[model samples]
Structures are given as C-alpha cells and as structure tokens.
Target: MASEWVVAKKCLYLHLPLALTSGGSFLYMEQYIVSARKYRPSTFASVVGQQALTGTLKNAIATDRLAHAYLFCGSRGVGKTSCARIFAKTINCTARTPQGEACNQCDSCRQFNENRSMNIIELDAASNNGVDDIRQLVDQVMVPPSVGRYRVFIIDEVHMLSQSAFNAFLKTLEEPPSYVVFILATTEKHKIIPTILSRCQIYDFNRISIADMVKHMQAVAANEGIETEPAALNVIARKADGAMRDALSIFDQVAASSRGKITYQATIENLNVLDQSYYNRLVDAFVAQDVATSLLIYKEIREKGFDSQFFINGLGLYLRDLMVAANPATLTLLEATDDVRQQMAERAAKLHPTFLYKAMSLCNDADFNFRQASNKQFLIELTLIKLCQLLSPSPDESGSDEGQMRPLESFTTSSPAPHPIDIPAPQPAPAAAPTKAPTPAAPAAVHAPVQPVAPPPAATAYSLGGLSLRSRGASAAKAPTEPSPAAPAPVELHRSKPYSDADVERAWGTVRRSFPAEPMLTGIIEAAVPARKDGDSFELAVGTPMQADIVGKQLATINRTLRNLLENDSVELTVAVCEGEIPPAFWTDAQVLDHIVANHPAVGQLINKYKLRLD
Candidate 1:
C-alpha cells in the first residue's frame, strides 16, 4: 500500500497538466493566488485596521495572563479568524519577538506557517455543531499538548452551535485544563448563548475603513506590478462596503478585466456605477429649468440600463453632497477626492440652498414610492421635472404650484415682438348741460349748435351705437352688462354684554354636544363644569392637567360658541387643573363610592343589605 501510494503521488505530479490544453497546445499556467489569502497578515503588527485589539492580545501574551476562553466577534471578512490564528501561533512560539509577536524562526511558528502545527486545532462549528461533536471536543480537551505548552482550539462561527452543544461544552469551557485554550469566533455575537458568552472574554472587531482598504490595495497593486488609478481604487473600495477581503477580490476582478490597467471611467463602467458627471449635468439643467434636456438625459440614462430607483437614490445622494458642499463649514462632510469636492462646491454655489433641499426631498419621495409604483419611469420623469422646477420662480403669492413644473407653453419658443404696442392715451369727455330740444322743429336756429364730445377711453367706455367695450390688452368683443353681486356684510359681535352663569353653562353644554366625534374632548368638557367667578369671568375646573390640555386645544371654538350663544362678547373662560386635595364632589363615582365605604361602615352595610349596585 505504501509503494502504491508513492507511485500514485509520482503520477499525480507528472500528469497534473495532462488534461489542460488550449488550441492544440499544452498551456502551462502559473498558480494564481487570491489577494485575500496571499496577503493575509501573519503577525500582530501586520494586521490592518485593528491595532488596539492586536496590541491588547500582545500585551496579554507578554504578561502571561491569557484567559482560558476568548471570543472574537465581528462582521464578515474583518480579520477575526486571522487574528485568532495569529494569536494561537504567537502564544505557541518557543522564541517570540521582543514585541510579543511570533518569531518565524521558531519551530512552532514554522509549523503554523506550513499548516503542520499540532498544538493549534480549528473546528468549523457551522458544520460540527451537535452535542456529540461537542462531547468529542470536550474529550479532546483532556489531552496535553505534545510540542507546545497549550493546545489552542479555534472554533469558527461559534454561534452556530446548537443549544445542547453549548450546554455540553459549558463546563469544559469554564474550567478547562491549564494547558487548554479555546478561541471562539462569530460574525453575530448576539446569537451565542449568554452562558457561552459569560465564559469567554469578548473582543469586538470593526469594519475596515475605505482609506485602509485603498492603501492596502495600492500596495497589492504595486507588488503585482499592475497599473491602477486612485479613483478606480476608490470606487472599488466603496463597492466593497468596508470589507477588505471583498475589496481585494474586486480589485483582482477589475485588474483582470481591464488587462492590468484600471482607470476611473473604465472602473465605473465595469462596475455599473453611475458617473457623477451625469449628476453634475443634471444639476446644470435644473438650474436652467431645462426640462426637455433633463428628460432627454434621463432617457439616455434609461437606455444605459440603470434602474429608476437606483437613479433616484443616486440623485438623492448627489443632492445631499451638494447640500454639504453648499456650506463651507459642512464641506468636510463630503467624501470624495479634492478635485471632485471642489467641483461639487462650485456647482453648489450656483444653486440655492432651498432648491437643493426641495430637490432632495423630491428624490427621496420618488425612491420611497418606487417599489410600489406601477409606472416607475413616469414617477422618475416626474421627479426630474419637479427638480427642474425647484429653481424656477414662484408663479403666485399663494405658491399653490410651488416646486412644480409650469405648463408646456412656458417652454415653447416664440418670436420677439416687432415693436412694443402703445397703450391709447386717456381722453376726457366734455361735460354738457341737458337742454330740451324743440318738440317740433321751429324751422329756425332756436337751439344753439351742440358741440361734439371726444370719445371716452376705449378700455372702459361704451359707445352709444356700438354697445361694446374693449378692455385693456383684450380683443374687442361684446360683453353682457350684468352687474357683479355684492359681498355679504360681516356679522357684528355683541361686545361688552352681560350674561348670567346659567347662560354660560348652557353654551358649554352646546359646545360639548357639538363635538361628538371627539369623545375625549367631549368627556373632558362634560366633567369640568364652568363656574362664573364674576359677570364676565368664568373658570373651568378639571381634575388633571391632561384634561386641561385637551380643553385648551378647543378653547377658541368653545369661547366663540359661548360668546355667540350667551350674547356676551366680554365673557372670558379659563381652565384650572386642581393641584392638590380635589373635593370629593369632583371625584369619580368609583372613587367616591370607595371613599364612602372605607370611611363609613354603615354605608357599605346598607348597600349589602339592599344588594344595591352603583350605576
């Protein structure tokens, strides 16, 4: 069997590339290593974005105060597992560096690097999470290390362990052998049982920053002799969303796709990232109120295969950045290259802060309803149109159609008028005294010759024979001579009139009945009866401030109704919340009944004898 295994191994190496061929030629391809694994940190100082945590671990190792159990918790691809492996290897190294890092020259460190270490054990709890598996682990804990002082067991995804498994491993984990060390790692620490958490010292990992990822990628690019642009790397880092592993993987993909040369335009195009140029142009169109150009640009974007919702969200983010850039103090909030930020600031200067606010709000609204909108493109187009109109002048004082696109006629082209039309000058009419003409012609110049009167201004005058009037700037047309109706006269309120307390109470009752829908307000008003302090002053007594607040909301309506009903404009109503020692009469039936029964035994006995109940 040994000889056969030797022969098989020889054959495997010799025939490894036997089947790989392209174009009838043997293709000898070099082994490719992924950046994530190839560049993984091997020592404490080499780990990126976790200096504090690594320092703490190094200090613990230096002090010889390592805990029996440790929990490394963080999101995916944040170096939790890597750090655990490094810690385990460092602790097991016979000769460590002065900085408490593992010395690679040591036998244990060499074994760990070559994946032949016997002191370190890794268990994938995601797969082996049953009680039986945990029992096996507990049994394995009894054995001492053969080459190292401690046997390190690293359990990855420890939260996946079953409840029974957790319980079975709790005792062993709490009081393991002196040479045993358990390291638990999980993406979700909250899922792990509290008992397991209590037995372990927890160390949380944070998501790597974009700058760190970009710097690491730059180093990786330099090592690989690949050309890259900072903007492209920035885009890749953002696309990774704070995962260093994801960023490296994306960097590799982009590098391969671009044939070792990565540029900003190519990167964005390859990743389907909408270029900021589109947003800048859109803002220009918005400032100019160019609806047609904006719609055309939107059509072009749609043709490029961007989703409407994605476009909306991108626009919103752009507008938000613009808002930040619009103010010099808040310019630091923008995350972009200096050139891009300066350009954004320049663009933002042309836009009013109010315009940016309203534009962002419209984009947000469009994005919020995007999923439910059946005609999504129309919604997007409408949003764009609204954004365009945000900078347009308001049409009326009421602002009824503010932030809305004007009619299509507003965008239509028209020729300039040849010359400005002149408004006709006003002509005064000649005043004349009425004279009685001769009933019958006397056949003589009995009446003096009548002087001709100049015609009245055409804008408001009616001709005797024409029976028509021409308004200013309006075409000549006959209009009916109907007089407009007069407006109604305002009601005069009765001020300074005196009324009785009964009148005020009746008015309040009417007010309460008027609001049946508002049961809370009605009940409050019904309970708090109004008491007349003087002929004009009235006070409402409520049991609590909450009731007073409810009544205060309707105070205006109540006062108006009372004034009209009582025929007294001088009547004033006020609300008072009883601060302390409310009278028994104001107490609720249940409270009053309890008080009576508690204070007077006879009252309870009488009620018991009669078998009476309070309604």
Candidate 2:
C-alpha cells in the first residue's frame, strides 16, 4: 500500500507551478469569484456552524483514535464537504499541532494547499456513482500516502451511489488498506447502504443558526469593505434558512446592487422579501381589531406582487418570532437584531399570549387552505378578518350564560346614561337628532316596574346595549329618609375609577355597537385606536383626514357616551390621522418651528432673538 502511494505521489507533483505562468514571469489573472467559494473554510475552527462535529473530529485526532471510514451527513451548504476536506488536510499535515490541527507548513501540506497532493483524493459520487466507478475507487484504496502518514479519500454526495456500486465498494470500505482512510458525505443518509453505514463513523451536522450566520456575514462584509446594517445582515441571514454558504451568496448579491451601503430596505427590495414593517402594521391592526385596515394592508401587499400564500406564511412566521421574542427564556429563538427584537418585544407586550396563539392558528389555517381555495384573495381577506375578530370585544355579553337575559328593546342605548324602562313609552325621534332626557317623575316611576335591572358589578361596567337586569324595588333608589335617623348612612353608588387603555377600548366598542344606525361610522370607530395623552384627553388615530373630519363631527356625541360610561365628566376626544404620524414629505418642513415654539416660551424667545427663519 505504501509503495503504490509513493509511486502515485511521485508522478502527481512531478510538475510544479499549479498556477500557469506565461514566459515564467507573468501569472494568469484569477477570474472574479463568489464570496461562498472565496471564503470557504480551510480549517475546522474556521468552519461556520458545526462546532460539535469539528470538536469531535479534533479530539479523535488528538487521541490517535482515527477511524478507518467516516460519514458526514447534513443538508446542502452546511459545510459537509468543507469539513471532509479540512479533516483530510489536518491528518496529512507533516507537523501537526498538539491540538490536532494542521500546521500547513510542511511539504505534504504545501502540495495539498496547491491542489497537487496525491495523498488526499476527492470523488464526486453524485456524478460517477456506477458500479464501475465504485470498482475503481476500491482499487485506489490499496495505495498509501507518499510523504504523509495516510491516504484520505473523500466521496461527496455518497447517497447517489447505486446499489451495485455499494455492493462493489462494501468490502473495501469495511476493511480498507492499513494506510488508507475513507470519508463519505451525503445530504441523505438513509439512501446509503446499511452495510456501509455500519462501517463508517457518522457525524451529523446542524443548520447554522441565524445569529452565527449574521456574525459571519458581518465579518465577510467588513473584510470586503462593504458597509452593511446589522438589520440588513439579519434579514439576509434569516433568508438563508440556516446555511452559511447561502447567506454569503445573498450578502454578495445585495452588496453588489445596493449603493455603497447595504440597508434593510435595499435587501428587502433585492430579495423581493416582504418588509417587516408590513407585519408590524398588520399586528397593530390585529390588536386594534381593525378589519378595514387589515384588509387594506393585505391589498397593499398584493399590489406589491407578493403571493397570498407567501403573505400568509410570512405572517405565521412573524407571529412565531414575536411569540418567541415575548418570553425571556425563548427570546434566544428570535432571529433578529437587538433593535428589531426590542420593537417586537414592544409589540408583543401589548398582545396576550392567547391572542398570539389564536392569531398564529388563523394564519396557519389560511396557509394550509390558500392553494385549494378558488378565490385566494377572499380567503386571505376572510382569514385576516377572523384574526381581527379574535382580538375584538363582543358586541353584547348575551352570548355568555353569566349575563342575564332581557328583552332587547327593554335595554335602552338611545342616551349616554341608561334610561328607565318603567317610564311611559313615547315615539322615537330621527336617528340624527339628539335623544331627549326623560321627565323628572321617570325615576319614581322606574321604582314601580315589576321588571328587573341588575346593579353593576364591582370593577365592571355594563353598556346600555347589553341589559343590566334588576328587579323593581330590589334596591333603594328611594331618598334614604335620613337613614331612619338610626342606622349608619347608606352606601353611595361606587364612583367610577380611572380606566386603562383596554378599558377605554372596550367601552368605546360597546358605544359604537350601540349606534346600529351608523354601521360605517361604527366600523371606523372600531378601526381607530384611542390613546390617552393627558387626563381625560384621548387621541384617536384615523386613517385619513376625511375620517378625522367625520369623527370630529361626532366628537360631542362620542365624548358624552364615553364620559357617561367611564363616569368621568372631563373625558374628551381628539381625532387625528394616527399618533401624530404622517409622511415626512407632507411636512417638507414648512410645517413651521413656530407651530411648536408657540407652546414653548423659552424656545420661542430663543428663536425670535436668533431671527431664525421658520422654514
């Protein structure tokens, strides 16, 4: 075996200058190469995402426990071939280190580096996988290294070998020449013969994590003098789906097209990937139960050329990532930059886990049915509507057994405060007109009714749309008669405590449902998210100025109902085009510093003294 190997080596490198030179002075210029090939790992430590396998291989070499045959199995682009090459090179290093890594300084290492080494052999089993090919490989195993300690044979895509090929090579693989070592690599291990598997040591490689991929891409970009945002790198990393080579390829494409810097927008554009902003806005709409906005966002996505199924899948993944980011223990599973993670955490903070789970289930179901449905657009729209509904408050609590039943009309929602059902019936006014207050005797008359009106529960407020059932004379609305001048004074009705944002939304939704005459307005109100800026001053975000004007016209009516339900007379409303956010182009800065400075006296004085132009 050793004599044959020496003879092959002597013939292999008998010619030098692996690089072709003209006139023995000028070398041929290397053509442009992709980053994936340029940055291929030459050492185990340099291999991108297989620490366990690499570590085990090094330890085996260090302990002098070399296996006769080894199998490297994993998905494509996961460094299987790279690891095999590195292992073969390390074993043949003439001056190997104590840590069991190649020195790359000896004659054997130099020949391998120049791709002229006869000791290390590589075969592409994917192409040459017939019985004849296997017979030839078996014959070659008899040879040993010329200067190195052993002969290494690396057969990549070994699963492609035919049954006959397997049978032909089985004996040689099971018991190779004493100076020979064999390495088999495949993306599919089950396809390989069981007899072959039994003889080789198997190393399973894992998909490279997004965090590792991002760090590696960052290093490559830095070395290439390309400036890339962490967010952009993270996007490319996630798109690579846990393959370092794929990530590098994507990074190369984006860097080439982007203008000097690789921004997140540039990557999304280049990859044709849906922007994260869309998902962010979609989640916002879901939380608000804004069906109109959700539908519109989906339409926008469609207009952008994204497939419905793709959108559904992306939404499912986005929710999954948000779910992972929501918990500290699972946050490590989120594949994003700290900035993106923080944004996701903020969004997640607003969502209950139940809502997130249900939202994900809706998206998954939509994805499952997307291809089967004839009208994919409607299917997706319906799915989004259902998702919005999951976060919406029920119009009436009558569905629940806990809520007492009453005649629907017996509950009056015509006014801000609930009206007495016992009052004499009267013809109703037009829907646009304000409801009139009942006469003074209405309260006394209410005490005479045999029907019931339940008192409000603690920490709970009931809307007039849903009946508050109570039996007549069940409670004392009667003037206390000075508390009978004996027992302690009667308990006053509980005052309304300040409500949180959730409470405000719930109350507002009920109020909207109460006005069944204006279905469109009710929907608009449902879509708008109301936020409290100061005591009693709530800002409601609308999609358009027209919506703002419409809501503005109802400002008095809405404030009255909200104040009555919330029991805060100071309750106020401000309808604006959402969170004071607008397109930057709209301002174009002639929005005017004086507009802001008018509120700040000190800043106004400074501006006036400087004679600064408003523009």
Candidate 3:
C-alpha cells in the first residue's frame, strides 16, 4: 500500500507541472531561506561586526597593494570566508565603487554573485586535505583566470590539511603566479604549518560582539516581517556566544516557534533558558540572608529541568555582571542592552561590593565542583546558603571557623537586646609567688550580688564546626566592674636572670613534652638540645629545611614558654638546619624488640611463643 501511495504521489507531482504549463501558468515554488544564509554579508559595507578588517582590505585593494597570499583567522562564523569572498569580488570588479566596494552591475561582480565565475574558486580543505588534493590545487594554480585580472583561490578550514599536503603546497603557496591570489581561512590557526603562515598576510578577525549581533538581527527580523522584543533578541545574541551565524540560526528557530511574534517569555521557553529573574530574586534572598527562600528558588529551578551545573555557571555570570555594574567605570563591560543594564545597576546598588565579590566567588566554587559532585543539587543549595551568609555580620568580624558556613540563626537583622543583672564587683586576686614556672590564673567569677553594675554588651554568637551554636555570654556576664582609677593595681616586671646549660636542657624537655599530639614536632625538637650562645641567646639545629621551618613557626611560643620556665625574660631561641645526615627519631622494629628484651625478658618469650615478627 505504501508503494502504491508513493507511485500515486509521483504521478501527481509529474502531472501538476504539466497541467500548469497547459493552463498557460507556471508554478514557481518559493524556497525558504534561513536567516543565516539569507542575510549573509555580500559587500564589504554590508559585513556585520568587522568594520576594521573590511576597511583594511578595501584600502589594500584601492591602493593596489594586494598581497599574493592572505590568511584570515578567527573562530567559527566570524565572517572569515565572507570577507575573503568580498575582497576577491571587489578586486576583480571592472567598475569599482568610490568606497572600494564592487559594483554589482559589472560582469565580474555579476558572475561571482551567480556562482559561475571561473576567476574565483572556493575549496573546502576539511574534506580534500590529502597530498593528491594539494597536487591538484597546485596544478590549477598554474593556469590564470580567463575572464578577470586575478585568479582568487579561497581555501576554507585550511588547518585540516595533512602535513604532507602542507609541505607539498608550501613552494607554490610561497611563489604563486603574479595573477594568482590565495586566501586561507581557518578557525584554528595554530594547526597550520609555520611555512604557510610566513608566506601570507595574516588578519585576525574579532568575535562578533553581542551588541553588533543583536542590532543586525533586528534588521533581519524587520525585513522578514517578524515582530521581536529587544530582550528576546538580546537573549538570542548571548545564546549565540559571539557567533553571528549561530545568532541568526537561533533567531530563525525562535521565530518559527513564536509564529512571527518573538516575545521574551516565548523565547526563553523555546530555548529552555533559565530566566534572569531567578538570579535577580536570588540576589534579594542573599541580601536578606534568607536561606529558605534561596533553597526554594533552587528547587524551583531544578523542577524546571535545568541542569545544576548550568544554573550555577549562569548564577556566577550574573553575580559577575552585578559586581561589574557596581562600579561606574566598569558599566561598559556588561554586554546587555541599556534598559537591562540599568535594571542590573539599580539592583546592584543594594548589594555591597564586598558581598558581591564573595557571592561571586562562592558561585564560582560551586560551578567548578558541579561535575564531580555526587549530589549536585545539594552543592548548589549549599552555595546559595553561603551567598546569603556573605552579608551576615560575623562574630568579631571574623567569619565562622569552618570557613564558609555559619548557623542560620546566628545571622540576625540586628543585635539581640541586652539584659540587666545585679552582681558585686569581684576583688582582685593577689599575685602568685615566682616559681620555676608560674601559670597565670583565670579571672575570678563573682557569685553573690552586692551592688548594681551596668549591663554588659550584647553577646556575639558563633558557630562551632558549622554544627552547634556558642556565645560569649558566660564570660561577658561574669566580667567585673571596672576598678577606680585612684587605686590602680601594681604591674609585675618580667625577670631577666642568668641560667646554666642544664637549666636550658631541662626547660627544652618540658617544651617537648607539651606537644604530645604532634609527634613529628616533638621528635624534631628532641633532635637537638638548645645551647646558650651569648647573654641569653641560644640555637638548636634540625635535620632538614622542612623541620627548620616547622620549628621556626613555633619559635615565639617556645621562647615564651622557655623564658617562663627558666624565670628569664631575655631568652632568645633560633632554629638552624644541619649540614649532614639527620639522626633517626623513631625506633626500628629490631631496636624496639631489643629494648623490650632488655627492659622485660618475658615480652621476648611471649613474642617467640606467638611466632610474631614486627616487619
């Protein structure tokens, strides 16, 4: 039945044209052209977003200083081939315009436009990139153009040519006939051999700016009788990512979906783009430190089927734009329309510059970790929470110890109200008698109430490991009233006494014993006993630079502890790396066994009975 239907359709199509001819009417079907090719730049003046390059080429042609070989380099869809073609047609035109453009009325221009000109040739090197193809191209170079002054050969994707092909064509490319002009266009110029690059005049094409693309698309939409919102056009241009070809293609898709009326809502829905309004609202939630609202917004985004990574990257870009808009000098950096940029600036005004910077950094971290994250949604939610915390007042202006997280309740709109408590002013304790090492006592806490005192400052809240909440209220409440200035407490003077080497060694042992949790540091300190050099100065040598650095970092703490232990206030200690082999700090298994046998003979017997070896 399918075959019969096909046969009938073929007969209908064959008869329809003949019937129309018999009726003295010919059916001319209109071919639908996509916006990309339909609006492709023809003349140099018509080229979009490439004024400087087009002008240079026009000047070269007008001044009759055209090079025998030219190289055009840029990313895809940036008018490399288009400019090459325009340059070729203009140079070969019998009658040129005063602006250095080809007069389309001339025979050369008309033939090139209609794709029948023998003077111009286009070779797609991506497919024919072998030695034989280069040989064929080289053979064709020998014959000049029959109709025009110069024969132009435009090679597209010139980087795809094989090494052998490049070597084979190098000679001809370097010294082509005077009438032959070679134009090489590539998206990746690094792949092309240096010989080919050196033989040509290189022109680096700029990426079509978003503003340029949007403006050009507007003109195309008008000509196509399609109504479009400026916001919709901006979205399309950004989606293209600096590619005019891509922008026009996206425009065609959106126009079809919207049925000739492209609105912002319809455009985003068609493209499956996350709305910028989500980011705008998210900024508000961050400023308010509203974690719940931010999380809810993330949930809504997930429900709309947007990937978490894409959402995070988009958020980072939005924050970056906000940061850029926060400064007037950088407002031009935003690639958005005036109205959209103005709205962003207004919203950015509400956020602090520091907050925007930190928020952007958080978003960047979330984006970088998105691919490796097992729970992508959770990562995004946590990032959003961190952004909210950026504006929260920190404890003593130092953020949480856990680095980017704090308890949600700790962040408040304002400080909590202080409460009054009646307590007696505590008496000062007597100073301790100087011993070998005197430990400072903590301030005494007042228990019973005697006289009224001023209320303490509001307790600052903090989070421990981002898990539990803690506050300084206990210490703040126990703090005694300030003493009267008439009878001030006496100050204690530090002791600077003379000590022997034995005293220094004993003090070093105490310091080493204190680092029980850090065995490496303990071992490093024990490698050498500090010796007095001059006055109260001393030095200790370690095995390596790393050990020296470790000891250097703790030198101040060690000096303070040692000075207190020795009752000397002028103690100074320095660490030095030794020149030779480092002494072993850890005991080997054999040494341990021998030491155990020497200390307790029964341990060796037990090891022998168990047939155990420490290796």
For all predictions, the C-alpha RMSD in Å is 25.5, 21.0, 19.9
Q: How far off is model 1, as Cα RMSD?
A: 25.5
Clashing pairs in 3: none
Model 3 segments more than 4 A misplaced: 1-28, 395-615
Q: Name the regions of candidate 1 deviating beyond 4 angstroms.
A: 1-28, 322-354, 392-615
| 1-615 per-residue lDDT for model 3 (tens digits) | 565455556657786422222222232344566788889888999899899989999999999998999999999998999898888889999999999999988889999898898888888999999999989889899998888799999999999998898889899998899999999999999988888899999999998888898899989999999999999999999899888999999999999889889999999999999999999889878866788999999999999999888999999999999989877899888888787788889877656565677778898899888889998888998898787766433221121111122111123222221222223244332233111111111222111111111111123222112211111121211111122233222233677887766666666656764433233344456445564556787665443344454456456446655775777878877665434221223433333333344345465444323323332
Error of 2 at 437 (Å): 46
Find the 10 residues in a row with the least total lDDT in model 2.
401-410
Instruction: Report residue 528 deviation for candidate 1 (angstroms).
Output: 44
Q: State model 2's lDDT.
A: 0.67
Candidate 1 lDDT, 458-556, residue by residue in tens: 233232223112111111112211111231212354566665545555555466554433333444565455656556766665544444554665564
Tens-digit lDDT track of model 2 for 1-615: 565445445545684323323223333244446799889988888898788889999998877799999999988889998888888888888688776788888888788888898988888998999999888887788776678888899998998988888888888887788888899999998888788889999999998987788888888888988898888888898889888889999988998899669999999999999998999899878765678999999999999999989999999999998888878788878877676778788777656565677789999999888889999999999999887766332222111110111111111133232221333334444344432211122232222212211223324644432321211122222111111232222233434568766567666756665533332234346444455656767666444333344455455456655764676656666664422333333432222222233234465333323222221
Name the TM-score of candidate 1. 0.59
Measured by lDDT, the strongest candidate is 3
> For model 3, where is the 10-residue window of minimal lDDT?
445-454
Error of 1 at 350 (Å): 5.8
